[model samples]
Target: MNRKPSTIPVPVLMMIGIVAISFSSIFIKWSAAPASIQGMYRLLFTSLLMLPFARPYSGALFALRKKDWIMLIASGIMLALHFLLWMGSLKFTSVASSTMIMALEPVFIMLGAYFLFKEKTAVSALLGMGIAIAGVIFIGWGDIGISANNLKGDILSIGGTAAVAVHMLIGQKVVVRMPSYLYSLIVFISASFVFAIYNLLMGIPFFDYPPREWGIFMLLAVVPTVFGHILFNWLLQFVSATTVSMNILGEPVGASILAYLLLGEQLTGLQWTGSLLVMCGLAAYLYAGRKKGKDIAPVLDNAS
Candidate 1:
């Protein structure tokens, strides 16, 4: 007799994804490769690793309707663009600033849901988001400045955040119909293709990287790209896009702590305070979400 497969709880999976993605910044910082180059290999390797697993779902992929195909391809392009812009932002701005700015993804997602889906948001959730945004501002207060280059980086990060928000919102609709692994495989493959073309256009060499850099690339693929992002894609089937994006706000806190421990980066008193506020606000938001009932209700409640 065949036994059934064991399933992990959604909350547990989300926590694991958060922890896994938190290391993405640290890995990027440790590598000496150019941002696009690092992003290219990371997606390329992730696609390769996912190939064997996705093969079983070949029929599912082939059965996709034209609309499904369009959404998947668009989502994949946005994902690639998000990585490119975010990685580029890291070159000119501090990690704290980049990550903090990227955390604005939820705001974009909320706005998209409102305009595209006619969704409303709860007042409590809005308050929580405000608190979290304030906390992120506090954490990055010192790093933000009026410099031209820094402003450019900030703009890039904001663009990346918008791209990713669009990706997730699309996934929220598509993933409900497609199997998680199959959906992720298609998106990853598409992103890898985009990255490959980008590398070729820029004349960036994919091979001949140092052994250490290759190792970092592999870690990024296996840990963050696969485990972290794929898990979020899977969770999108159960939760609203806004909820998933809000949870991602924890990345800066996790990345900051890792930077402190691994990279010897020091945090300020305000940063510490801000970290606590973020945690508290996130918890409040999630709690309010659960209490509201329905995956969409938390984000769809009237603002009042």
Candidate 2:
């Protein structure tokens, strides 16, 4: 008889992951380097730091099939593009506007999974997506008023969201077939390579950045890339994909709160309302998924 697969508990780990990843924007803002240069620095430092844990030079990476290699490269390239668009969006938009627009990631993830991977979406997922969209629309209406600059930033943010979704969707497939650590090492390495090339191509002045900017870049690598991605990969082992998707809704809220605390950026009433609705929708979806997991555990155990 086959045994049921073990999974990590989702709630606390997922929350931590989102909050850690949400710190990227603030860190980027704190760094004085040019956006693309900052991204390049962050990716390089993050890949080097993750080396101890990921150990990509090991035989395990060499043993991976050609398909896994492709996934890793694709994930890396997509993530690099995601960061490029996201960091660029911040230049022309408020943190609030950029974050709110970037929150559309989960929506694309859900839709992409349904279409690309043929993952069945629960009615609850559809409903949660609707709620999240409404919340984004509400926030957008309030703080993202139309201007040429705002429109440009909004477009870039949306492109970032799409890029990340493609990255995650490809990553999910690769992780199921190989060790997550090995797969992630490839992703980090590829991202670092892509960013380095981008910096070279753009001719961004990287040599003049001060030690303060380097310090911020180091912090960003440790927090969001290593800590956040590790936690997110770990949480996936214990939770349903839908549960993980719901938890990502916390990113924008956590980011907004952090910005308010650190930068004195204020959150409007509409933003607060949207955040609450997002939380509510996520809560509703996760509650149902957890109950379903609990319900299925015993029957599968008995079969084993």
lDDT of 1 by residue, 1-304 (tens): 2433327776787788777888888888888898888877887787788787777788887889999988888888888888888888867665666676676565677778889999887788778777767776665554453355765676777788888888878888998788767776788778778888888998988786899999999998888766676666566667665566555666776777777788787655766666666666665665565567634321110000
Tell me how far candidate 1 lies from the true structure as C-alpha RMSD in angstroms: 5.8
Q: What is the lDDT of candidate 1?
A: 0.71
lDDT of 2 by residue, 161-259 (tens): 888878877886777777666666678678878988887888876677778888988887778765575565554446545555554556677787888
Itemize residue pairs with steric clashes in candidate 2. Answer: 7-238, 8-238
Best by TM-score: 2
lDDT of 1 at 243: 63
The top-ranked prediction according to lDDT is 1
Error of 2 at 81 (Å): 0.7
Question: Which stretch of 10 consecutive residues in model 2 shows the poorest summed lDDT?
Answer: 295-304
Error of 1 at 155 (Å): 3.7
- Model 2 residue 253 CA deviation (Å) reads 2.5
